[model samples]
Target: MVSAENSSLEYLRSLVNYDINSILYDDTLICSLTNNTDVGSFEVKVTKTNYGNLHDCIQVIANSQATIDGVACGTTVRAVVTRELVTVQQEHTEYVKLPNPITRIVDFISESTDYVITITNEEGKKKTTETKRIPKNEAQGLILEGANLILQRLMIQRNMPDKVTMLSLDSSSELSRNVYTSLGPQQVNINGKDIEAWGIQRQIFETKPNALPIAWQSFFSIDGHLISRYQVGSPIKMKTRNIPEAEQFDEYLPKPEIPKRELEWENDLELRSRFIDRRDELIDDYKSYIYQHPDINALLSDFLQSVLITKPENIIDYATEFFAPFNNQTADRSLFRFADEKIPVPKPNISLK
Candidate 1:
């Protein structure tokens, strides 16, 4: 005669073959017993794959109608268990088209005689007319480099400058007193190579009173005909924002002065332990609050569902790609490899008595 344990084991083994094995990296497990007979209670054991180690094994009390087979079976019994996976693979791909380059230069004059340059190319066009405060000695060189850098940065932001190199500032001459006297091209050594460089000559002037002067000059390139020339100087007036005055906290009270204190070396371990304990307490409190507030949980679930449903797939792709570099293996495993192993399913255990 087959014993009840043997029969139950056999039944469980058969059910394991037919029961759908779902791969849920991080999800909740829901189990419901619709029918049973002569069963007072049941035991379930969960094991980890690859390791074959027992994760959790426990027995659940049967309900009023629940039974081993059918006699002691309960009307309806349900169990929900949630497990968190250490690693997960979420794949995403994005297709981007490159932009054109600037072929023409556009001139923009500010209200205060500040000249700005905009370049248009095959891929796209970029313009910068606002005057940026720059040191007089490095103004021209920075203007050349900064403008191109700004455009390149913008293209990078737009995800356009892929596999293409644009003309940019290679080297610049420093401002010197000699620049005021010498009107000829200056010999500069750049990257272990001596080259005759030219552009606008930079000179320091005492009369200008906090202003630097840059004189337009010519450079002798390897091919010879002066490649670039520009003169940059101080602006007559800088633009500023109008901020409203903040209201005084006390109309007549005098402002209090704070006394500075010297640094002290307290017990770091104790401090850290206190902080961690406080943090854990706060987190536990929050979880308890959430558990007590079923309405809030329902509202949150609804909000999350709505967000996931209404979010554009492309925007998610873009955001994922943008943050892919920063996420760790647990967060962004898909970015690094194709055949990464899936996270193992956690065993179900009795978390509460």
Candidate 2:
């Protein structure tokens, strides 16, 4: 008789064989570098492919138009493993073509259990380094990049309790293990609708004594969609109201144009001019880092000057993306408060003063 755990792993293997193990999700997420949110999208494809003698392949690509470290960046990560999901190969590339041109590509190959990492520079120079052999469990469970959907699926499939230690493939270092504690299932409201989700806490610990671990909480829907994610120290959040079906969107379509009129504050001529001017300034400085930049005070001063402009009712929807790097709710409220102060109301022609 096959155990439930074995049955779950077997089911995952079957999905890989038919190339049905894939997910596409879109979201607005905060960038840690800019401290602002953007229309971030993630696509993950896992298929059965023949890479040398290995056949399982996993690819993750993420893109955001927001600036990171003073540059617009996008990343694609590819990982190949055996049927059991043990690492056989991994590769990552980061491309930044706006404001500045920068590209980094690295490859990791597993040979006799040890990993050899090779990095290629723009000059085509190659550097190679080696890391000690990773444990089979760590290699099998390493998450290169993607939604928590995969992890959540496995957790629920196996009925795992307590915590699970999964390796984070963010870096080649062996210390990137993320320990996730399952908080069980909870009910949450999404888009004014109630839904049941699995809440999980992810923590990254350091080898140093008494050091604080980077931690965050993530929630996934029963159908394996990552619905919400929150981190400490910042009120920023990431959520997807719906999980998109595969191939529902076309990738080669022409990019849509931004609506100029939507941002124009026409009710007040002065407000309209100021709002338009500020929007132009932000577009000009789109490449600049918003979080603790070298001239942060000057940048904030200029940004504060624009706060007096009359904010549109839909400002919250635009502020998260337009503010580029400001705290989301804070920026939204400041605009609202500024609008309240500037817009005067006549009280039925009655004066009390």
Question: Which numbered prediction scores highest in TM-score against the true structure?
Answer: 2
> How many residue pairs of model 1 clash at the backbone?
32
- Candidate 2 minimal-lDDT segment of 10 residues: 1-10
Best by lDDT: 2
Residue 145, candidate 2: Cα error in Å is 3.5
Model 2, backbone clash pairs (residues 3+ apart or across chains), number: 0
TM-score list, all predictions: 0.15, 0.47
- 1-353 in candidate 1: lDDT tens per residue? 11113332232223222111221111111122333112232222222232123232111111221222222312221121111111111111111123332222222221223223222223254433322222322322122221221222122222231122111111122222212122344664433455664323333322334644443332323322222222344111111111112222223445899999764435577777888899999999999998888888776586567567768567667556555565675366555574565868898786765
Poorest stretch of ten by lDDT in candidate 1:
86-95
Kindly list the per-residue Cα lDDT of model 2 for residues 1-353, writing each as its tens digit: 11113333444444443222433233333333235455344444544556775544433334433344455556676766554455567767777665446667777677765566566545234344444444444344454433233455445435555766655543334436567788899886766777888888877655455666667787766645566775655344566655422233345546999776664458889998888999989976764655436677785566556554645466565555557646664555645567445667866877677
What's the lDDT for all of these models? Answer: 0.30, 0.55
Error of 2 at 130 (Å): 7.9
TM-score of 1: 0.15
Native-to-model Cα distance after best TM-score fit, residue 26 in candidate 1, in Å: 62
